[model samples]
Target: MKDLKEQKTEPVQMARSDLLLSLVKASVSGDKNAVRTAVEGIIADEKGKQHRVLAERLTRALHTNGNGTRAMNQMAHDTGIRGREFLAELTPRHQLSDMVLADQTRKTVDQLIEEQQRASLLRSHGLDPRHRIMLVGPPGNGKTSLAEAIAEALAVPFFVIRYEALIGSYLGETANRLKRVFDYVRTTPCVVFFDEFDAVGKERGDTHETGEIKRVVSSLLMHVDELPSYAVIIAASNHAELLDRAVWRRFQLRLPLPAPTEKELAVFFDRHIQNFDGKPGIAPATLAKRLGPISYAEAEEFILDVRRREVLSMLETPLKTIFADQIKAWEDRAKPMGQEESAR
Candidate 1:
């Protein structure tokens, strides 16, 4: 019996080792199909060892079926982008009315949504709906939100490119990863968003930049040019000045979302506070005056902080007290650079 068990385990051990080797190779080479095959092989090996429950558990976690990424998205099974970690695919829920925007920006978004809705009609007229979009703004000023809103308005899948995973240091690696992203999105009608786009789209003319960046930019622009209007590409940059000159021309719409003025902040404040169970005791205009110009993200954070204090206090503290206490802390945190600590 001991001899029989050892002989039986010998083949299983050998198969396990081979499968693990394949897994390592597939992972290092970034081969998704090979990884799947290796994992399935391992699962079979586990089953051969009479570890049926463990094998079934491992098989369940492997997400071998087409429904792993997006259960309802038929495109997941149809494309090679399945299981890609660098692309976060989502069904956007934000509407245009969810956030405040400048009048012109809002109108342009509305127009784009309308154009996309009537895209077939436009195609019949031998025209493609405008799809390439560039959003320029400071951090936390609704650039990302606006992209999501557009995708939501169009009722399309929203794909956010994860730069951390997409940017590889190896020669030609980054461009290749970017190409895969564009190819994947092109297979289906979806909204692809590249946030912090200046990271890849930086000016090729910059004295400090390397040839690698220039080549990457060239590759990116080529992909953008070839992308069909059916797949919308939205890229947001904090430093529009840093983007390649060619990148600007590639985008059909380059929208600027600057920091909100005091008045605009007040309007945003009024709209934002309406959702709260209790309104802020301080008026929007007065709060804006005291807060100075800040990103909508900061404004929202301040509001939430005040609400947190209010909630923790069990509504014992007045809204006025909460606002007065939090505003000083908010100012200290948000003060302009080069301002002295004492002055702050």
Candidate 2:
């Protein structure tokens, strides 16, 4: 009889052990929601009042994870709008060295490093970091890439705001949604990125705009002000002129991304072709200079296309011939656009 009772309890004990293991795994993986859920399950299964109470305490502790953002997390939960849907969690794979930036852009990167270090020390001194930043330039100039690099350097959760999902058709709904996002940010340490910011942050005084847009802008400005310094807010805009003047003042660091210079172009081309076995007969400097003014994104695309063609040909053709042929094709495609620009 004693042996049978021990056997019965052994399964229960084993189940409890599994639960504890799951909780530890979830915590280590930075899944706060999973941790909370597991704790709740443990509390439900626990027979003793003391054990249940202990489990409840653990659940509460897991809610914030020492970030003091429990209130914001709770508010986000109460809103019923899933924060994960609109806020994409990013794990950066690229480092600063991988990015080829211009001299002015490099200065901005240095400033970001300084701010991050200062923020860490200031937290101990009861102060916060200057976390608000703005990236302005034409499309495909590496604004988004810079934001990712900053997030990686800071080692924080990178949350990109999906404007399409956040914006609503109903009156006042958009403002409410925006408020929830801001509330969540207040409770966590993350890099919140708002790409294509002009969609919602346009000038309020435009005659073509409606009252809804004005209210949305007001809500955005208010949230920007209320956000804690622990959360880094990075907004990117291709049309910087469209943004409200009030919005411009909110960002502490404003970095402008420009088209790649001749030197940058050469470096980019060299990096792209470095891994390939075949040598481009033409020098990278000559090709880069001939390519004219193009964005880093365009250069990457051109190099990739050239490489793809070379691979398809079974490496029979020299890379230099392939590079020259690709460049000529691209130039021919752009000739019409260039002519139109000149006509204008």
Candidate 3:
């Protein structure tokens, strides 16, 4: 007994001028590519609404623009080379101020930031900014954070290279995907971070490695060389010794982030713990001394654990008691580096 009107599909939510604002922005930007992309998006949207006549008209209009049809045809052919296939866009949340660095590291990072901010001035005098960086460090340090912060500092798009999506089972697949990655980033300025870079950039001369590894390394370095100055590549590797000899030459700056000292860890912990509403009962330095050697990541994680436990306690446990118990528990679980190696 339903009415005939009820049998109809729900109205297209965006049928009434929702895409017009995008069209306006694209038109004002004077970027033909952006305008074309916006128009095509509208066409697709309209087609989904069963507005076949209107969609056909929009398509005809788009085709009239110089090279639009040809460009779209090319796009259709290379539809597999999508940014999402090998890249993940990240929100640039961290800034240089958000991290604590050694004196030398801070100075170098500051210089790079200055150079990038004044890239136009440098280019006018026949200079290119230093954009190729190799971050060598132990795991659990601030390598990834540093890359993200640099992108934030420069107000650029931050993209992390997804090895999971990029690596293929077929021969020559990985290199092709890497090339596609470089091809997409070249069109615009961005921070392209290759974390755990040694996975593909291993030493070519290492006979223990496969021929495919050699090929991937070669392709990776080639793309690195070809990328424009505007496209910053920040490659981080824990096993720096495993990277190719040629790979070492490709980077403009090779920075190291070593394991933190007790004082340094304490300082880092203090900065983080102050952010929590339930402050630590003991001083960060005292707590850090109790925890022994640890990475910046571990310090942050410890703070999180303390905060979580404190919040869940619902005011039953004193913050000081909770803080002391956490320190003891964490220390008990963490083995000495030598003991871990021996056990292995």
lDDT scores in order: 0.79, 0.77, 0.80
Give per-residue CA lDDT, model 3, range 141-164, as digits (tens). 899999999999877789999999
List, residue by residue over 48-152, the lDDT tens digit for candidate 1.
356878877775566545556633323433334632567998777567887778899888888998988766455545566899999998999988888889988
- Ranked by TM-score, the better of candidates 1 and 2 is 2
Instruction: Give the TM-score of each candidate.
Output: 0.72, 0.73, 0.75
What are the clashing pairs of model 2?
A: none
Clashing pairs in 3: none
lDDT of 3 at 242: 96
Cα RMSD (Å) per model?
16.0, 12.2, 12.5
Clashing pairs in 1: none
In candidate 1, residue 230 scores what lDDT?
A: 68
Worst 10 residues of 1 by lDDT: 70-79
For all candidates, the clash counts are 0, 0, 0
**Better by lDDT, candidate 2 or 1:** 1
TM-score of 3: 0.75
